[model samples]
Target: MSKLKFFVFVLFMIISVSEIRSQIVINEIMYAPLDANNEWFEIYNNGITPVNLQNWKWKDATSTIRTITTQSIILSANSYLIICQDSNKLKIQFPGINGIISTNFMECPE
Candidate 1:
């Protein structure tokens, strides 16, 4: 009986962890821009706890997987993170926008 209880607990934990990981989702994407370099996407953390995004990756339908960041990035709970092709250009295009900005994002698919 104890072993069965332990197995159930482990399954619950695994499901919880998967749910938490799924909370970080792609919220928005700017595929086409007046300046191609201004392309970007928004990722939102809807979970209650912050998520560590170190060594995360992304890719479009036509491209291979690309690394998003190698450095540690803690996305706060209920907040957004912006990944951009060119941080400087995106800033100039949308002045005073909020959220954490990360560079080196590749072009998004249409």
Candidate 2:
């Protein structure tokens, strides 16, 4: 009975850890941009399922934590999301770029 209980506990721990693992990844970052206030970072969803980004928090190496989005935003599987400090500046910098642009990150560390 004790051995069976230990086995069950181990199985439960494995399942719990897998479920808690995140599929979102930070793909790219423009930490030092030539244009002022043009800092941006790209996040990719590598999982098969879409993930909601509402209220998700992130912080740079030298910045405080900030919410990713106030509104409900879904990041589709195998898709990229760009979080920028200045949307207008990013658009002007990369005129032909595409994908979801979020202006939630107020500032990025240089």
Highest lDDT: which candidate?
A: 1
TM-score of each: 0.79, 0.73
Candidate 1's TM-score? 0.79
TM-score of 2: 0.73
Candidate 1, residues 1-110: lDDT per residue as tens digits? Answer: 99999999999999998998898999999887787777788999999899988867787546767677777889999999998867777777788887746566644333
Cand. 1 Cα-lDDT: 0.81
Q: What is the C-alpha lDDT of each candidate?
A: 0.81, 0.78
User: Per-residue lDDT tens digits of candidate 2, residues 17-56?
Assistant: 5753467889998887787478788999888888888777
Tell me the spans in candidate 2 whose CA falls farther than 4 Å from its real position. 1-21, 104-110
Lowest lDDT 10-residue stretch of candidate 2: 101-110
Provide the clashing-pair count of each candidate structure.
Answer: 0, 0
Candidate 1 lowest-lDDT run of ten: 101-110
Candidate 2 Cα lDDT to native: 0.78
